[model samples]
Target: MRRVSVDIGGTFTDCFLAFDGSYVEAKALTTHNNLASGFMDALGNACEQVGKDVETVLSSVDAVRYATTLGTNALIEGTGPKVAILTTAGYESTVPLMRARGYGDGLSEAEQANLPAANRPTPLVPVTRIVGIRERVDYKGEAVLGIDETDVREQIRRLVDEGAQAFVVSLINSVVNPAHEKEVERIILDEFPTHLLGSIPIILGHRVAGRKGEYARTMSAVIDALLHDQMYHGMSSLEMALRKAGYKQPMLLVHNTSGMAQMNSTTSLQTIHSGPVAGLEATNYLSKAFDQPNLIATDMGGTSFDIGLVTADGVKFYDFNPILHRWLVSTPMTYLHTLGAGGGSIARFDRMWNAVEVGPGSAGSDPGPACYGRGGTRPTTTDANLVLGYLDEENYAGGTIKLSRRRAERAIQEHICKPSGMDLIDAAKAIKRKVDHNMAQAIFKEVAVKGYNPKNFVLLSYGGGGPLHACGYSDEIGISRILIPPFSCVFSALGAGNMNQLHIHETSLYMMLYDANLRQVLSDFTEFNRTVVELEAKGREDLRRQGVPDDAIRARVEVDMRYGNQLAQTGIVVPFRRMETAADVITLLDLFSANYATRFGEGSQAPEAGVRINVIRVVSYVEHEQLRLRPSEVRVGTKPVARAQRECHFPKVDGAVSTAVYDASAVAEGMTIDGPALVESPRTTFLVDPGWRLTMGAMGSAWLEKITK
Candidate 1:
């Protein structure tokens, strides 16, 4: 297969090209002003490596996939259009109130604990723009009061006159019944038809999120409406750029749900954190390819450090109500936690500890790090790495940019060293150690919370900064083995190439499998079976709309079930699509019990309280031919010649050590390099600390195994 995939991140844009039997990787600084410019620059770099022009390569490629942080950046930067909400009468405070817990959404545990410091995110739509209409729908899907057509028209016009750029109709209980919401949409369109200059896009709550929770569902629709124009224009510009380069195929977008779809089939909410999710998908592929079913994937890039888990048990983890930026929204997103720790993470002196503290703040791409000499005066992890002699000053990013050692020293001296009583080397060492500890703690918490042992999984480290600090963080987590995958710099892009086209459809309803209240079991299966089929049909139609054939499509069934009146619902993927017999219901309860016990603890199952299914979901996907990857083989004790030597400092070590440096492009497959050593590539560098050894493998793949505790 001849294909190209690209991942646009905060600091850089990475591209992966797979053709015939060759794979190429390329990188370029991200152009925030115009994402397409950075995208084409990275692709052009890959084309140059293969001796082809952009037009020639793009015209003949099978498919072009994109996994980007565009939507995420827009949300963080508040670059979306002003959105107005229309809801059931008397719920004017729904968006503003956002529930009591909404104030703590997207905040750290410490910040959440400090009540006086907690505050809700700035309102996406002000209360004045959130006029309510006379409409009501009960949880039973019964419309008790029809929406007044005149009321709907007047409210939409009032919002428009108040400078509303888009409209969101999110009446109460819309998930169970959308009649009131649909009527409001019809009224808005009639007042301002598509052909008129006052026309606006209308986003229905039920269509954006097919679940319950009035607050979460409404926020989902509001966020979708806010991001609609930004995503559409950004995506359109990218597509136009591709067309100018002679590409005729429709561009596919990677979604955070571990699926891919054409632009027409995607929603703005699905694109948040897509780049990181694509990296996790690559980890899933690596788990099978490397014959290691359990792995911890870590991507430490310029802006953030992301951690994701993939285990041997075929269980996929998803967050049904994940917080996007600061807004809590209801969407089924594949779970991946991000920490504001990376190369550009700024380091400051914390007076409380009399030591250094690394970031939840970053320098991003523009003005990058102090070492970049791009007007960045703040001391960052990148500056520390450069000061410690891990990065070559003249050869950084293949000489596309030069590093300034003097500037790095000046930043550290003025900020970290001056605040504390420490010298430059000690300050740099402290920054490295602190950042590594922060990442290790986050990984441990993510794994332990899931009831998995960090020691049981091998760490798969990628991104530009991952290999450089793999030994430091892996040792802290008690992990002895680290696999830096082939094309590590563009691993997420490679994963995007292997994704299947998929769509998910679901509905909220109350169904009892075992009623502890009545001491009875479910005797009727007709309603349960019908809901599953209806959800399946919706998913099938979605895939068919994207031109997928019936034979190529398949479906999976999942349901969110809980015990008693507990707010936590455990999602279970059922092996059987339709439950016919009483035994099938028992099987579902058993599945939920087992999964719950695994997540919480053994004997934590509360079937004695009651058993109920809150939501039913169907996943329809069309499997495409995946790009084949060969397993990497390692040879031990075959040492490669060194290119040079440099003096590097390390934490917990006495002083500067003479480190042997090797050019990554010149190393032979299966050659080994023992620490303390440095492996330098044009795009990234690998640091092998003392007590660790590096084993070279095929296709730029390598292993960093710790030799000592």
Candidate 2:
């Protein structure tokens, strides 16, 4: 079994190759101008390590899976074409108005609470470009008024005259009846043929989102249309490069829904935050492989720290209407909470507190951290790490790039130490403490908010900066055990390799499961069964289009249900696909009750008012053979010899401690190194702070267990 997977992040491109029984990992700085260059460089590095050429490796791999940030970058940089929205008459302000709570979407709680600092992001489609078509469709699948072709053409021409390069037809309630939206799309395509030079791409809300929210659906289509061009070209260039390197199979793209599918079968909206989601998926696989049923997955990279949860009951948490950046969109995304605290996050003195504060702002890859000698003048967490002697100046990233300790000292002394009136070592320690505190708070909130205790789950830390600081953050949250997974540097790419081919389809409808006021139960199962079958067919067709056989396809059903007059909906995955009897309806209600209780206490079940299912979702997938991971049985081992020594400063301790520096590549399974120690791998460094023991496990995995008193 040979496979290759790559994840393109903002700062680095990571690659993982599994050939027979050997697994290799590599990384390279990302080239934002041409992403394929970074992809090939990382892949070439891994191929060279395996004693194989790029052509031979590409030709021999079973699959080449990719999880890229192209869509995310496109949205962030605003490099997309101008898109115009066409909605029903009297709803021209729908996209511009957003929702009452749209301004707070994707913002931190502190930022959200600051009413005076509230500012909405610039609209992807301004009000001037939004045109209203003369059409109306009721909540039911009934047309109140048919759209006029002349009205549609004139409105479209007006938008094009006003500098609209793309179109989004998001008529109200299109999910219930999409006849008007389809008609508008047909007219636009007819007016501007695809073969012509002046043709523009058209997006329909019904196809992009299968739910019934007016603002969310429209924004989903708008985002899809906005990112279409950049994602297409970026993915195409990667594919062309793969072909040139002797690969003949279809390239699979990892999705934010915790699945993978052919490139042609994906939507741009489904690709946002895909790299982080892939890492979470890999954690899901590791949870089962290592027999740790509950795991908290944390990825600390150069720019961001992402956290996700894997529970013991096998309940997959999903955000059906998650916000993308500042726009609330209707899409099913694997739940992940991200904090802006990472290695390259800038540190500054807070005047209000008269203390050092770590980021929500990053130096990124262009100038990077001050230690990189890349003209970055700002103080960053990386600089603090360097000042504390946690990093090797001449051997960073396997010596691919050299660090400048003098520059790090200058940046920190000028920015943090001088402002806070503290010395250099104290300032660096303060910065480290603040950043770790921020991440610890975020992790605890993400877990506890879901009604789970942080102390019960084992911490699975990975990415470039994870293992280095895992001990600090884990201790703050009362977590005593941490597992640095195998291939920790490129864990997301490894996750991409384990994803199954899958697609999801859903529809919005009003179905009563239980009526408390009337004291009656749902008796008719025809509509429920029909809706399930239709959603299943749509998902099956999507998988079939990607060459998955009918026999190999499997589907899971989920319903978004809520109590009477409640705004929040709880998505419950049902055991059976089709509901043919009242027992099936009762079973769904019971499941929803249990899930809701788990999330909001056992006494919070609210079936007294009424219970209704608002949306029905179907996930169809074809399971592939996963990457086999070797299990670790050794928990204690012989002491390893140190290769060198370094004096490192700690946040909790005074002065400097002489730390044993060991070569991570030389250590075999069943070797233990007691802290304080430094295990330097090719791509990352593991800092074993005082009172923590590092135990080497199989396949480059290690355990960091704190010594209890």
Tell me the tens digit of each residue's lDDT in model 2 across 163-196.
9998999998889888898899899999999999
- Residue 676 of model 2 has an lDDT of 91
Candidate 1's C-alpha runs over 4 A off are 634-636
Off by over 4 Å in 2: none
lDDT of 1 by residue, 322-357 (tens): 998889899899999999999999999989878799
How far out, in Å, is residue 615 in model 1? 0.9
